[model samples]
Target: MKNYNKYARSYFMPPKTSMKWMEKEYVTKAPKWCSVDLRDGNQALIVPMNLAEKLEYFQLLVDLGFKEIEVGFPAASETEFTFLRTLIEQDLIPADVTVQVLTQSREHIIRKTFDALQGVRKAVVHLYNSTSVAQREQVFKKSKEEIIQIAVSGAELLTSCAAETEGDFTFQYSPESFTGTEIDFALDICNQVLDVWKPGVDNEVIINLPATVSLSMPHVYASQIEYMSEHLKYREHVILSIHPHNDRGTGVADAELGMLAGADRVEGTLFGNGERTGNVDIVTLALNLYSHGIDPELNFERIPDVLKVYERITKMKVPERHPYGGELVFTAFSGSHQDAIAKGIKWREDNAEPYWNVPYLLIDPTDIGREYEGDIIRINSQSGKGGIAYILEQTYGLDLPIQMRESFGYRVKSISDHLHKELGSAEIYTIFEQEYINLNKPIQFIDYSFKSGEQFETMIEVKKDGVIHEFTGIGNGRLDAISQVIQSQLNISYSNLLYKEHALGTGSDSKAVSYVGITNESGTIYWGCGIDVDIMTSSIKALFSAVNKLILDQ
Candidate 1:
């Protein structure tokens, strides 16, 4: 096993050569996209999604303008059959969209599949049979001739069954695992099916050839697809389709190249979730077109909501690093990446066209409903003042002096590494208040006392500047009481200080950090933070911290 692992590692370790070839074969547009999220994605699930979840996901696909969706294989189970019946019975199937069902050539299953789609407006019955040598030898123990017979027979049965349906029915046949199949034999089987079905110019038949398992390089796969597409006898009457799996992690490349080779349709799941590595990511492929200034005709702004529904229904967590939709996909923690993204975003904002031509941002985050403010900036051990100051400048538009940027960057690095978490905007304000703004401020909270209950009356005392100032005030809560006490003792108005509290950790014992931002007579904004187990105390401290900073700056 170890020796085989080593051999596999060595085989894949070679530097990728597909990038150079990709540029040569690049096309301006993509083909029609079909989502197999319902069928293939469900089949790969440890616990399949229920009917309600399927309905929600189906609605999402419809909303995204997918004209063709593989709803499921009705012949597999009673659950699947009922789901198809529900779509037909509830009249949920859209008029323009076509629901596709997968089945083998067996007469009984094909009939059952048709029965499940009795009232659908338009649907496609996709029939497939194993035609590759390994599948024929190991699974069916059939010869090439026998396999061809099976495929032809299945296609004939599907054609006969669909003829009786009220809706406009289309036929699709796949020589399953066609990439490794003998080219001549595969072509012969496809021709036989097309002949039996007799699809004409008005009614076109689809022959989807899937690289079910990627056994060769992407170029070889493209060559195989081109071979069949060019040699097909009734090319004018056929809709060529390609389904590429990412077993070699090149499903996207293979699908793209297949389109370049004249495949009319592509199939995959969103975020590439499916059997094995996964089917090609339709989201990635579609957005890839959008990035190149072509309309992918898909709305990605609704992707996060779709992801929420899918995650709930599938009972799977979308990894935080998944492309486009992931939490951290646009975040850059490395200093170099942050610096570049920061500059790029600024240039794009300043000029009529995007500036700096950054290496990281392929598409702007705002195009997909993500916040552009915090999208590029992240804090870690390797981060620098440029990244920190960029975040502040971008988020709040506060241009920090160079000296202040360096000083605050050191403080951010110090406490951020100690906490081992990315410092949020409030945290940044806190560090700025403590390190730069309030450097020599004498106002300090030595200690504070607060008592509150159902009665709602509170008393407070605070020590500031080495002097203990005690004041008793009655109010709704501890924070209000403290504010009243400070107002009376210090003879200063703090009506402009706005305090907001956020939890700092999980569970009952977690601390709450309060952020306070105040505008004073000079109209300068001051921000501060306070952390404590008691939220009221935290709020009071944060307000006082902001006030102290403002006074010190004066």
Candidate 2:
């Protein structure tokens, strides 16, 4: 903060205005996605991936539906060179996919890049050189005319190499730090490279403008991209591309806005892994389009599987809060969020909603192989009645009554608060079983037989305080008759008994579950649950469960 005054803006605004990208609402179509994970992302890692891991990661990129992937700077290392050879030698590169290799404006590196591409069906010979003013002054110490010659000579080298090469080749050029370079100079270098390649419809060149160091907001980058898209030679044949770094934590924004500005391709890494803050997150960008009802053309249906392999090979973890691919991105722990999500899920099922419009969630977690029970609503001290009840009903098929749900919710929250940790579904269910269901103490159900007469007659035997007793009472219903017998014979006074029963599931082995609530003189209601094979027995047990709760509390 103290040296903020010394840090002036390094990025240059275009000399001409190109702001039409602001009119577009969102990206409606998928771009030519190029995963630079092996080259750009791999270089950033402290422990870079080896040849085997690189191969596995490449297959993952292919499976994710990327048509273009920058395999590596083959000329930079023996391992990278061998890896490129391995793909070609083994016929691992698909027929439709093109592997791109990076090289500088040098003869030997360019020749060795072509050497690694031998026997390949198709490949991109990428050439780059730094053109930024700061780089020219401090790093390369080259004038604008000299810098143009470096790119021109490299482009010429690529054309010559491709003429003698065995495979079909496409040419790509990048002004290494495009954003920091003046917009006019950026255009000049790219056009010079395009002229050497002489691109046509059949052989389009990719002019990738990288935010080598993201120096401004995303809008500025978009304007710069628009300026190139408008002025670049062979505009119809060129695939305008952007490689945005996350220095400002807006690489996705830069890519999205760049596409809106008429860039045709995006070069990024999965989950935005690369040098510094990393490349634009291709997964986020694609899925952003997906949530807007556009197909990203990339397969993210099993994001977990992708993440597992990525973390294992890259030795980097996707943050728990990372969009779509994170462990806790879809998980709700706040009471209000959980409640709304619970209601939203039920609303969808009840209405048979055809679209995803859940309150807090942008897309259904299941769309990416995440579930509602464990992944959507997790119970903690902050959980609410709706979420806890939803978890129970969705998981264990216990549709608790509304009042009972409120009472049970408090019990769960209190225990979770005391434990100072979140409770898993199994732990929550265990608590339910211990605290509410089939509680037998001070009063217990020994046996019961129900008969229908003028009113329902019940012959019931019960154990009260370790004593066995038998009594009879008649009322309008069987439960009423049992209640009358208990109140009179055992001298237990309770009223406003409410009961509900349901079949746990549809099967011969399925049992009946019943819930009971009894209000005492103090205006407090005690709740209980019972599960049995017979409906009548379950109800009787339920009444005794509530009675035991009332007695224990008294």
Candidate 3:
């Protein structure tokens, strides 16, 4: 922070601006997605992926619906050249999928890049040259006309090499470090290259504008894209694309707004893996469109599996907070968030809603192969009644009463808070079993029999300390009859008993779950749960458990 005075704004704005992109609401349609994971993303890794890993990643990209994949910069290293050869010779490249290879303006590199592409079904020979002022002054030390000639020469070499090579080839040109280049110079070089290629209906050229070193805010980048998209030559035949890096932590914003600025394609990597802060996250960018009811034309339904493959091969961890694919992205730890999510899910199900309108969730976790049980309502010290209750009902088939849920929620939260850790579903269920269900204490129910008559009569046996006691009670029902006996004979003062029952899950061996709540002296409610194959037995056990709980508390 102390050296902030040394830095200045390095990015340049366009000579003129229409700001037409500002008028657009959002990216209404999906862009043609190009995965540069193997090329740009792979090069950024600490230990680049091996041939086998690159092959696996390419297959994954093909499976994920990417029509164009930048396999590698074949001219960069022997590993890259070998990887491209493996894809071509082994016929790993799919029929509809086109593999792209990057090359510089130098003839030998361009020639070798062509050698790797030879006999390929289809490929893109991506030619790039540094056109930024800094690159000209410090890196290459060239003038404006000289840099434009570099791009033009590369563009010419691409066309000639494609003619000589025995494969179907497309041309792509990028003015590398585009965001740092003067807007007019960037346009001049790109136009010079377009003139060399002369793309038309049959031959399509991709004019990739990369924020190689993003040095501006998102709006500036969007305006830059808008200006270039309007003035680019052979505009109808060109597939205008953007490849943004996260130098400013706005790669996703740049990609989104750039799309609205008439760009037709996006070149990025999964989870934004690349040099420095990485490329725009294609997964996040695509899903952002999907959230707006637009199909991003990519398959992300099994994002967890995709992430697993990404990390396994790339050896790069997707942080827990990464959008869409991270482990904790769908988890709600806050009490109010959990409660609102629980209620929203129920509302949607009850009304049979047509859209994903759950509160606090941009998209359904289940839709992306995540679960609502453990994934959504994760239990922690910050968890609330609705979330705890949701976990119980969804995972364990025990829906606690609304009032009882608040009491039980606090109990679970206290344990989690004391333990200083998150509680899993099994642990939560264990807590429930220990604290509420079938609790046999001073008032343990040994056996009971019911008789139907003018008044419901019941004879029940119980254990107190180390002795067995018998009591006869009469009331409207079996549970009420036992309650009557306990109140009268034992002098236990309790009233306002609330009970509810539901069948847990389905099939012949399914258990009946019962809940009971009783208000004791001073108006405090004690809650209990019971589970059995028989409804009456479960109810009786629940009543005993609730009563014993009160006795223990007293």
Which structure among the candidates has the greatest lDDT? Answer: 2
**lDDT sort, best first:** 2, 3, 1
What would you estimate as the lDDT of candidate 3?
A: 0.91
Query: How does residue 2 of candidate 3 score in lDDT?
Result: 100
Clashing pairs in 2: none
* Model 1 Cα RMSD, 1 decimal: 11.5
In the order shown, what is each candidate's alpha-carbon RMSD? 11.5, 1.1, 1.2
Worst 10 residues of 3 by lDDT: 366-375
lDDT of 3 by residue, 264-382 (tens): 99999999999999999999999999998999999999998998899999999999999999999989999999999989998998999999989999999987889887778899999
The TM-scores of all predictions, comma-separated, are: 0.77, 0.98, 0.98
| Candidate 3, residue 399: lDDT | 82
Model 2 worst lDDT window (10 residues): 435-444
Q: How accurate is candidate 1 locally (lDDT)?
A: 0.77
Off by over 4 Å in 1: 1-24, 354-356, 438-554
For residue 215, model 1's alpha carbon misses the true position, in angstroms, by 1.3
Off by over 4 Å in 2: none
lDDT of 2 by residue, 334-452 (tens): 87898899899889989999999999999999998888878999999999888898889898999999899899999999999999999999998998888788887877788988789
Candidate 3's C-alpha runs over 4 A off are none
